[model samples]
Target chain A: MSVVARLDEARAARRQKALIAFNATTLRLGGKTIIENLDLEVRPGEFLCIVGASGCGKTTALRLAAGLYGPTSGAVTFDGEPITGPRREVAIVFQDYGKALLPWRTAAGNISLALEASRVPARERSSRIEALLRKVGLPGHADKYPTEMSGGMQQRLQIARCLAQEPTTLLMDEPFGALDAMTRQGLQDEVLSLTQTSQTTVIFVTHDLDEAIYLGDRIVGLLPHPGRIGIELAVDLPRPRDQLATREHPEFLRLRRQLFDFIKATEH
Target chain B: MNRAAILWRVASILVAAGFIAAWQLIANLRLVSPVFLPGPDRAWAALVRGFSSGDLASKLIGTLEHMAYGWLAASIAGIALGALIGSSRMMRAYVAPSLEFLRPLPVSAIIPVAIAMLGLTQGMALFVIAFGAIWPIMLATIHGFAAVEPRLYEVARSLQMSRAAVIGRIALPSALPDILAGMRLSLTVALILSVVCEILAGLDGLGQWVLLSARAFRSADLFAGVILLGATGYLTSIAVSLVEQRLLAWQTAAR
Candidate 1:
């Protein structure tokens, strides 16, 4: 069998297991309900996208999955175990890449942070960092600091740092929200391919409806004012989605229109 | 370097030379008494004589030693206490009021108390100097650590870093620019307090030398001592800036 076929077989086997689940999860902050009765389950290797209007607690939901925040009323679990805090097995990509990365550290040094935390031997770290940097399309730019890199490059470096963890699940909070449209499209394809090869489960949050349809196997639209799931759609677009062709696909447009109308209704 | 920089350097040199020439002219015309306001020549001659035949070298060394010891003590204590206080909201809440009250109290006001507690010894001088110098370093460290980006801590959490590692690897480096700035300010405070302590405690330093020279009406020796102190301050500050430039090379490059 081909490498891709064997990987697909492995991913199919893993899909039987639920990697992360939120059972009636509700979160309250500052005497205000941010997320109310959020019920979600992400199967292993599934690309799940949460699309919503502003104040819809999409980022907050991603935080719950990352164990950066705990649900106030219900349980958030990973691998059938309750998530009290962040584990090394899950990694996050923040939208504000500038603030997310360490300004003092070079790209290589930032990637090394994960390796160091995982207790990867110092001798093994350089090669792993180089490989991860190459994987994220940042080859030979290790010594560049975050401030020295452009916005897209910095975001790529952040992704490289996350990939260094070799995480089973990637939680992204609008990772490309700050980028230009061209860069955003490039990164969207990159993330899709990276997750495909690794079969990493992803919970990507964004307000952009087209981005949601383009990247996710399943998309969940959220309503604001005590954020909760309002619309759920299964994307039937063909595999290895192309920016132009996949977006032009009739199913993709239909899903986009549905999400757009859902968001517009939520605003009213 | 560039034309503007070279021009500025020349302007500074000209101003210094003109001031020296004006002083010489005043001394030559006896606008002021020669005993009270000697020419730059007399002061230079006295400086050379002090270093060559007099005990000024040892006095200079003594003052430097006192300042170094005090500054070192202050830096360690300040960083330790600042980190402890800054890292915890509870500790900050409990200690902040007392720190605010103590912060504004003059270092000079405590000299007599320090002298009474420790006597007129090197220990007392060291204590007074360290006490005086520690505030800037500690306060700056507190501000630096407190002002760290909240998102960095979230990143640390996501990484599953230990609490100690979070502080050491993340907070310390993040707060470094502030700490270095504080240390630079404290260095000046340390030097000033060292001189004051020496003069008060009758310790063997440039401060004592200056006090004795003034009392004995040796204006040239007094002026020489003051000039040496000024030179010491200038050189030490430059040394600190060099260190800051090296450690915070990333900050400069980011800009």
Candidate 2:
């Protein structure tokens, strides 16, 4: 049985609020179709990963979901309301975390820039920033500038900065794709753990199939040329998954191969 | 900023003093005329005498007031116009050719017309100085705005900040360093224009004093006026630089 079917059989039944829903969405730019007829629904607090090739509109779809821009056609609803332009309930973490986090600001101040922008009260902001920094294992480094920190620390700071909004839905566009392997592993675990605590719905984009399967509750695949949903694979792996066990799991390898084949097939 | 740097600075000063001493020896031996060429000591005495007699003290206030007026006018005009042009390509296109045409014409070339219209007034000098200084400030501000990275704008867009907020926060801060650099360049134009205008018109200024002494063949006083003018130019730049450093503390650290 498939992961979803097996999950359904184990649970017997299920009902939950939909966090994000996209219906017959078509995104076009200058006569070129990017995402066409993409329809999907994400459950509340689910860790969803999107896997696709370059120029398959994965980033564009993520942008639409975040409401940076509206769909060229059809609807993308977040928390049951049609998204228009950047919602306060939503926050996006980018591939270039360095640029998104203000360089001039210290690690704590960088995180606070978002809060200040949002008009979060002063005392609460400081306490929240302190908590977030410590949560990211960057307690003493709070006063250090972004330039003074390492690549991994910078990425972690970006995560902390995004979390300043206390956002319900976190849209990340290849957040870990730029990091070194060790740093990537550390951050993936940090993000995964934090997602559990915050119950933040995650719609993450990546080209890495293994990463998609490793981190996602459901791995979404997209085909190129007016990109449409190709495969929807639910990851039924147990929680509190150790990195080694998760990577070495037979099911993980099987799902990874399946996603790899989907992407490889598209090149032909 | 440091002990080693201070020592090196003093060493350079000592070297300059020795050169001046050699010049004094050469001039005293009649290789140069005291009428045409005054040595460092003579010029220094002339400066001291001028200061004590208040030849320079009163004139300096008037000159400084003129510079401030011109500097403020240029800053306001350049930043406002440059920002408008920078924000709109159509405005840039319409004005750019005209600016390019005007930028090359020496500001000093307008001295006669300025004198005719304003009649040797401080306003005339201020007008000339502002005209001379504004071109670089405008160009730099425009370039700074135009050259902002596309992704930064994407961040602002994603934040859903209002257009005005984006300009006030992101655009202004991002353009600040370049704007300061433009101010530094324009500082030169302001000082030079003021000096040139002062000399041409009947004025109570260091420049006017220098011209008056030059005609009277009071070489030491002329040289002293020249030295004082150079000092003022240098000091104005240094003051702006200090202000730049304080205001742009974030920028300096990034670099």
Candidate 3:
């Protein structure tokens, strides 16, 4: 079956409840409250962008949603089930900037590793690996190592690896922060087009306000230290976004400035 | 051919021969007794005599047997103990200090205790050689385990690999360079200890041949045995280095 069909089948089975919910949650690390009493939800097929300064627990919130960590006193749930650990339904792209690939394995093998773990049929794995690599604009680079690839290419390979699971929700933690400004824009557009085409739920975290406004269906602005939702703004721009025109649109620029002003004014 | 380079090489060897000839002539002129010194030709004659008698063959074979057996035992024990220490955090913590303390003690010192316990036998000698040889391999494994980048471990985790799988697939392959380097180091020391055991213990090996020649005042025999020992040491080291290169080709390719 195709990835969309398989994901649709999975989501169809779990459609009665929200895909993710964080209910009055708090996360404590070494007895320091990082994020406290934060309530959040990611509906199916929603492109949610989380924006905050460094150390604002934006990444913490993403980790909590991805089931990498648990709330200290509250709940982080997927399909109304409390998440104890990472599962196949959710995959994370860490901000560690694409160094997460096994150097021993080529790009094709690295992308196919998850499928191997999931016990996907050996007869069909090659095609899926190829399709995922192609989907991420890395069709002919499958034999290269992560080290051989550039920052943008490595991130794209990580994307392919993430997509190998055909996950229902993608948790991207500053995934493009290391890329150049131009490459970042191009990748943001690719992310927008991919999400819109596939109807996959994405919880993207980024430092740039312009990036959030350019790609988000809804921008989740977070304040520093015990991070909570500082402001939630909806970007009404049409999907299948072109970077130049969409970014130049009056609504896009105005929304970018307003979020920047909000972030600037709200932090202590 | 590079004519000038070849000429220079020939000149250097001739210079070396001249120095040796001067030493031989000076010694023969009563500057030093012939019993205390032998020329190159005398050393060659002694080598031929030992070979024709068929004793050197058996002695060489015996020495090789000890070296091979001891090396095998040391490698297996070292890898196992290294894996155990490298794999477990608590075991590593408790074991680290003791390994540090024991690794520096001289291998020859253990000979007296070994002889006291097991008597003058190849078993005791082999055991001592293996014991001394193990620390390099163990430390290689430990340094490799400790020095592996945290990024690589996280990559293994993200790949959903099992812990044992990580060690087998990533850790060993990554640690191979250091492990081979350690093996090279330990092999040299093992050779020396083998000779030391043979000499001090006066067992029927090349070391015994050297002592016998010395006591009999046969300078040529002493030089012959010494040359053979040097050749064996040099040849064994070169062979191990070649094996190391083959075993660690992937590391060089990565670089």
* Top of the candidates by lDDT: 1
Error of 2 at B35 (Å): 1.1
Residue pairs with backbone atoms closer than 3 Å in model 3 (clashes): none
**On DockQ, who's better, 1 or 2?**
1
Residue B100 lDDT in candidate 2: 88
Quote the positional error of residue B153 for candidate 2 in Å: 2.6
Which residue pairs in candidate 2 have backbone atoms (N, alpha carbon, C) closer than 3 angstroms, thus clashing?
A: none
Write candidate 3's Cα lDDT for A19-107 as tens digits. Answer: 88888999999988899889877788888899987778999998788666778988998888998877776878877754577665678
What DockQ results do all the predictions give, each relative to the true complex?
0.80, 0.50, 0.33
Query: What's the lDDT for candidate 3?
Result: 0.81
lDDT leaderboard ranking: 1, 2, 3
Best by TM-score: 1
Which 10-residue span in candidate 3 chain A carries the lowest summed lDDT?
A: A1-10
Write model 1 residue lDDT over B1-255, tens digit each, in one string: 999999999999999999999998999899999888879999999999999985999999999999999999999999999988987788899999999999999999999999899999999998999998999999989988898889999999999999988998899999999999999999999999999988999999999999999999999999999999999999999999999999888887767
lDDT of 2 by residue, B1-255 (tens): 899999999999999889989988987886888889988889999989989999777767667766777888998899887888887778888988998899899887888888899988878888899988898888888987776666667767766667887777777777878888998899878877877778877777777888889999999999888888788888999999999998877655645
- Which of candidates 1 and 2 is the stronger one according to TM-score? 1
